[model samples]
Target: MNYKRLLFCLFTGFTVATSPAFAFQELQPSDDYIQVSKEIVEILEGTHYNKPSINDQISELAFEDYLDALDPTKSFFLQNDINALSVYKKRFDDAIKSGDTQVAYTIYNLYLKRVEERLTDLENNLSAMLEGFDYTLDESLDLDSEHYTWAKNKQEQDETWRKRLKNRALTLKLNGETPEAISEVLTSRFKNQLKRIHQTDAVDVYQIFVNSITAALDPHSSYFAPRASETFNINMSLSLEGIGAVLQMEDDYTKVVRLIPGGPASAKGELSPNDKIVGVAQEGKEMINVVGMRLDDVVDMIRGERGTTVTLEIIPSKGTGQTSKRIKIVREKVKLEDQSAKKEIVEVTRGDDTYKVGVIELPTFYSDFAAQQAGDKNYKSSTKDTKKLIEELRKEGIVALILDLRNNGGGSLQEANSLTGLFIPSGPTVQIQDQNGRITPLGDRDPKIAYSGPLAVLTNRMSASASEIVAGALQDYGRALILGGQTFGKGTVQALQEVDKGQLKITQAKFYRVSGETTQHKGVVPDIIFPSVFDTEKVGESSLDRPLPWDKIHETRYPIYWDMPSLFPILEPRHQARMAKDPDFIALNDQIAEFRENEDKYKTLSLNENTRIQINEETEKRELDRENARRAALGLEAIESVDDIEPTDKLVYSKEAAEILLDFIAINQLAEREKAQQEQAN
Candidate 1:
């Protein structure tokens, strides 16, 4: 239910079925895979949070999901293939339970055949199409084929392939590649795709089949192949020496989903979320086009020894065009120095008085578990680092503090509890509900309060899991003002169990805040909400299908440190007035509105070359105008063109949140002075 878990699901490689046996030889599922399938089913039915019955309905859904997994774009398999595989739709549950995976293997074999046939067709047709393709034609292709039925026959499949190939060629042409270059690239990309397809073995198919079953139970529940399990561990540990960006496969493209806060990519500030990596090259090596490479293979290519350089060709997520840029980065370990909690001081001028507010940016709730096990007294952790930062800030004469947890996809539940202990006296931080409906409270064991000053917690849509736990606990205790958009709402707990040669990541429990609110589908709502570009319907847990619902439990008794709810009414109007006059805030709102509008307009693209070019130009111009407007409002010079604007020039909503923290500091100071005056009178 966390971002890493989602990435694991996307990045885990799976194979699809091809046609009947003539095109390519069929590989049958091994006895080992069959045995593992049986074990997986037993575990899911017995211990999974849902405890779902493997009935006919579930089997039928799994069957359909398996088909979709194989031919998601409906590019390879024909209607005849679907018909041939339909016989197993109602019998998958029985087969899985009995350790009879013949049907699954049969489907996989068919898929392999279809892929072989498609590759042959593509190779045969590429030369002629590349030689005589007309770019100026007023033609378009519906790239989103989810609603379309499977191709009725081979002729229909051929037509679909032709359109798809033409679209690919047009995309390259739009990017200014020469015809000869386009031909070579397309030929190589297709050949590599075929080679990867051939590399899919029986274990890969077994993982895919079992995942289809687990995915039916819930989106978070999955079966990771042995190698995939290793990938999952690396993702969770964040100790690997690499670029420090989370990669996932989307529509055959490896995408940069997130950049770890202190990683090389984040430090360089060149890579961004949703940017597609089409090609990767080693230091002083020829670039390899990774368009259709397996996620594991691509990861291997990106990862290397520390202090090594890797270059990436990135297709920007913006607009409907295929423009790309290259970025080179030196790999480094995601060390404590990069991921550990960091501190800064911001001086705010209110009328004549200057107030210093300390800001602590927590990238993750991380801890050196190995170091602790090794009995190192200096083991690094979020709580320890945060405590030290607070002490340093206190010595520097700070009035208030802000715990910035933006984009922190959480880690270590123990760290979340200990981090909450840093602010408040002993109390329950979060509660866990297991599969049998047993609720267990996880409280802050440490009685020491690290800092008791006025506090605010900053969050965004990406603030998830342990981040939600910490923010929700602090808010529930009335110890800190929660500021920003709602958190990511990932409340479920997953446990990885080794089954035979693979791992089963099953959802075993759910998380609840001390105040009895579940941070599942509905994440923690900030006391003071800020403007965000993320669409809740598209980005949060609520957007996911079959997510655990939001619920409540009995509230725990904890003493409130401050009456924040009572103070919000007085602060809301003042904050609104400030935002209305602030140029940066105004620009942020305008940009958010424009973003929403563009999202709606570009849901389906005009594939015609001229129309696509025009749309891209318009989008670029609009973005440029918005950036210039923001710069002018901030008393900075406006750039004449979009190309002149650097990546760091992009507007950040956190600056507005920081300003709010300053307001909070000033108001709290005024209240404390008034209280002192009253005490003197008494």
Candidate 2:
């Protein structure tokens, strides 16, 4: 597993990337809140519905995802209860349709009342229990096998995490590092972590209880206390006045999952991913121990005035038993641009001809929903910018297009559909199903097909949602051949419905191909499945906390004009043959395997100079292998020896998979030939 996959497999204490545990068992929801939230849901389902407005639906879906995040076994209430209680959903829909929560407050009040009741119940029930209950149950669930492996609750999650750190700390301590140096890193985090539990255990319990009731309704609706619900909105595009980084609660430490590189924390150059912070302080002040404080409270301190400096004392998590040290940095504002798509070109040569293939690396399918809603033509999205890029590439006479969507966590549905339309004739793009089991067809609005020649989609275990839509549609219509690992299996569509004070992000429907097969759990199987360096078990929906199961529907009849067979037969063999001689590909596989073997070696590291020298030597050797592999792949000459290295300030190679440019060039030759034949006949 690469860093991304390892980061996922181990979660924060096995957090699985950007989220804390979603499913916690033994929840006792506020019955009254459930009753009211249910009533509101019913109202939104009926007369209050207006095609599920964006902001409203976002609020709802966000709330829903949070609710689902609470159930440990992903079994909140009994299945029978869900079936029987679904009757009130339409009432909630009606209330939503009544326009604005103020007017619809009647239905909102119902949901609110239930939430309030649940809160009262939690206050009463938890008072009796005191320490809170462990919610994870050992039930067999095949939905997401990974969930079963997650550490349950804060206690389980934190204790296991603390031990891991403690073990690493002991390793460092034994290495002869001063106790004060090690203390500078782990001791504060440990104490702060404990203090957090002592203070906010009740908050987590309340979150669990409320989420339980909301999750039972559907994975979308829930009650939010003022702070948490606010945080949820920020997670789902809540324009909050703070640094833009998604922090996950790990035992007692909050781990930085997705860092907006241009944002305050990332830009501060003080904090980096996998770097654990033990002490945080404002400028000119003494560093404070925040170890045992609740994540939210820590967050409150971390997030503050724009341009104001807050120092974060951190230890980089390069590997385990690596000496944990301290460094401090300031915070600033992080915007979406820090995580958007970038464009470049890859040169491929087959036989005597060279083809310049334009590659668009979309890290994520992000859109300025706020700007678009306000009718801002200046709003940013993948469709608009990529269109501009295509025109530029066309001017350069590029032979083909490679859309790279690996590791994209998906974004706006509207933009994803629009993006697909850029490649195909305007038509229905994806189909969605609601809670009522009614299917709604979403389509491409534009009629123009952008570039129609040879196109290839690059994906992996991380490409998801909107990215999946583009790849799946292209595959279904024969517009493009998908290459690399399987795309992320997030075919479910979520809508956030805004409530009075919070929102519910609910899994309103599942997506279907032009052929009506949903990519939910199965993801998009590539036309060419590469021997991915990725450990499939370690990423995508499989790695999520409470992801839904894979399902399918009757097929749709949308047809394509391209022949998939001609390309596949030749393309597959050519790719396989290329990899055989590809030294870079070979080295990558070896590197991945070796890392897996030594994944736990960090614990054995001693701070002794000899041990440190050995580790650094190994790191350098691995880097040398990687650099040599990259040098060979890019048509560059190989190093004469391991020591004959190209000097660089940093690691030159990125973890992204190299596109099969050779296969694409070969495929294009076939396509160009077909086009010529049609012209001659005409």
Worst 10-residue lDDT window, candidate 2: 648-657
lDDT tens readout by residue for model 1, 238-263: 77899999997666689886788799
TM-score, model 1 to reference: 0.91
For each predicted model, how many residue pairs clash, with residues at least 3 apart or on different chains? 7, 85
What are the lDDT scores of the predictions, listed in order? 0.80, 0.57
Error of 2 at 311 (Å): 7.0
**lDDT of candidate model 1 versus the reference:** 0.80
- The most accurate candidate by lDDT is 1
Residue 450's lDDT within candidate 1 is 91
Candidate 2 global TM-score:
0.66
Per-model TM-score versus the true fold: 0.91, 0.66
Over 118-214, each residue of candidate 2 has an lDDT whose tens digit, in order, gives: 3233334432332231112221112222333334343454443333444444444544656556555454444444344334333354444335434
